[model samples]
Target: MTYAFGDTDLAARRLALLAETFAPSSRTFMVEAAHTGLRLAADLGCGPGYSTHLLAGALEPAHTVGLDNSESFLDLARATASDKVSFCCHDITTGPFPSGPYDLLFSRFELTHLQHPEAVIELWGRQLAVGGRLLMEEVEYIGTTHPVFTSYLEIQQAMLTEQGNSLYIGPVLDAVPDPAALKRRSSNVQTAPIPAERAAAMFRMNLGVWRHNDFVRRTLDPSDLDDLESALAAIESGRSAVSSVEWGLRRVVMDRVDP
Candidate 1:
């Protein structure tokens, strides 16, 4: 499952597939994001609009912006985008983010991709409005119940690295980004429960969710395809599925205190 810079299209396709797998959990994730009252939210590295769609309808804000560098994704995003929302395609790290002081700077699985997710966090924090919150959903590979899923994931990950891709931080959450600076305002984290029947799909779904730079397809290999099929079958039968095995998700919410 080695990835190459040339395979962006394939990577996008694979992530789109994975997004379909985790589509089941979108509602729960969205509900929590909305309840947080993220009025001026920014979906950084928004892939195929998974959480963006959820956020747009969930928040009653005047505007929500979906940001990403992928032309493929922005096209789909624009088509699926609500009239209340907007889209932008640009390299987030290099390009300036749309003017902010945003009520919410939210991103799922986007931070970990950065060589320094923490640094990115610091930058995003600067964009927060007074009383704004940053809700980040990140995945770390702890382990898996299904042998095929775990092995397949490791292989895929190794392949991605070989292709010069840097992954989001490993699932060891505490190391991700410390909230010591953020705690003053108020911060908390929780893990989303994954049902066993959905395990295989869940793990693969997490890996596949990035959809960043058409990541999955570039990393895909014959073996990876086999793993995906097997996991999908297991999930369909409500049996041991190839999900995020041992790794747990770390959701960190940092809010700016209104002084």
Candidate 2:
């Protein structure tokens, strides 16, 4: 399945900003969930290697691999590779993963873009060593009173829904029964409040990437999109004193159980 956001340079830039904005929350999650002396770790859908680097830094795994399907993104990721960190161009959802029996598996904001996330989680769990952990952070809710933010979110959600994916997939994942090999250890929501300008910046960059999609073109008025873009630009420029958007991220931790 194609990512709704293109893997162009602009998209990479957006992801960089996204990584910067969300790193604190993600780092905290890793520190809280990780065990000492992990042998191997994988960061799923590790676009541009930001989250991969974060994983390595936070957990200090003996070896860490970042996986993504985009060669363009992998190229950027490879530039920053080290003895402990590496990049692989692979689709995360379908995997006999490059490395087996990982001690830790991490994915952030990736499931919302994929179909059958529960199955994906199960697949990831199978690649973990016994008692290894799989950690996922996905959107539960996005709270904002800004009309532009609301409008953009609605359109994005509709487009994802049309694609048979969900924008806020936390609840869906929460309801998934634990697979035999992966027992749920913890599930909870963590709030990350993003500054209005920063939120608009990310949203604007995302809109630019997916605004030309067939679903978007067929369903939305071009003029409205243009106006929406203008409104987002205003917010991104700090001209609008909009309320900060609060992201309620669902964090789930599962342990690979012995078969």
Candidate 3:
């Protein structure tokens, strides 16, 4: 599966901002859903190690391994590796994971990029030790009144649709029955209100990553994209303050039910 967002330096920077924006929600999910005494944890699709570090800090697992396909991101992740925290370059979607049957598996904003998320979840569940938990955080809804924000989302959703993915994949996952060896423990939406400027900054950075995408160039007018980018930049720079964007994140926790 191709990542709509490239893994360039700019993309890494955007992910950094994204990690900062969503850390609170992810931390709360870990605190509420994960049990103590976890021997090992894996942060799937870890980018630049931010989420990996977050997991280590929150659960304090005896060992934590972050897995991703991008070597550049892994390089950054390894730079800050600790005795208890390490990273592996592996495609998380296809795994006989290099590591073990983890006590916990965490992924944030990852399922949206996948084609067969349910199958992937099942694969991940099988890699977990019996009774281990899998925590997933994904987009349920993004509520925004600003025109620029709405426009950006429309284009993004369209592009993802073309790729056989969904930008709003939370409700879709909610409908998926528990995958083999995994039983649904909890699923709920947590609303996070992002400041207009912060939201604009994120949107602008994301637009920069995918504006050159073939689908984007084919489907959107160059002038319109230019306008949207400028508008987002204006908001991000504080020259314009639009209404805040509210994200309803679906937080799902599942427990391994079979060996």
**Which one is best on TM-score?**
2
lDDT score for candidate 3 against the true structure:
0.92
Predictions in order: lDDT: 0.59, 0.93, 0.92
How close is every model to the real structure, measured as TM-score?
Answer: 0.69, 0.98, 0.98
Model 3, residue 32: displacement in angstroms? 0.7
Clash-forming residue pairs, model 2 = none
Deviation in Å, model 1, residue 197 alpha carbon: 7.9
Question: On residues 67-122, what C-alpha lDDT tens digit does candidate 2 reach at each position?
Answer: 99999999999999999999998888886899777999999999999998778888
Predicted candidate 1 versus true structure: per-residue lDDT over 119-207, tens digit per residue:
66666766776667777766654455556555656655665565544443434334555543343332334444555455554444444
| Rank by TM-score (best first) | 2, 3, 1
Per-candidate clashes come to 19, 0, 0
Candidate 3 residue-wise lDDT, 48-164, digit = tens? 999999999999999999999989999889999999999999888887888788899999999999879889999999889898899999999999978889999999999999999
Q: Count steric clashes of candidate 2.
A: 0
Q: Per-residue error at 250 for model 3, in Å?
A: 0.2
- Poorly placed runs, candidate 1 (over 4 Å): 1-38, 160-173, 176-181, 184-247, 257-259
Judge candidate 2 against the unseen true structure and give its global Cα lDDT, from 0 to 1: 0.93
The most accurate candidate by lDDT is: 2
- Candidate 1 has a TM-score of 0.69
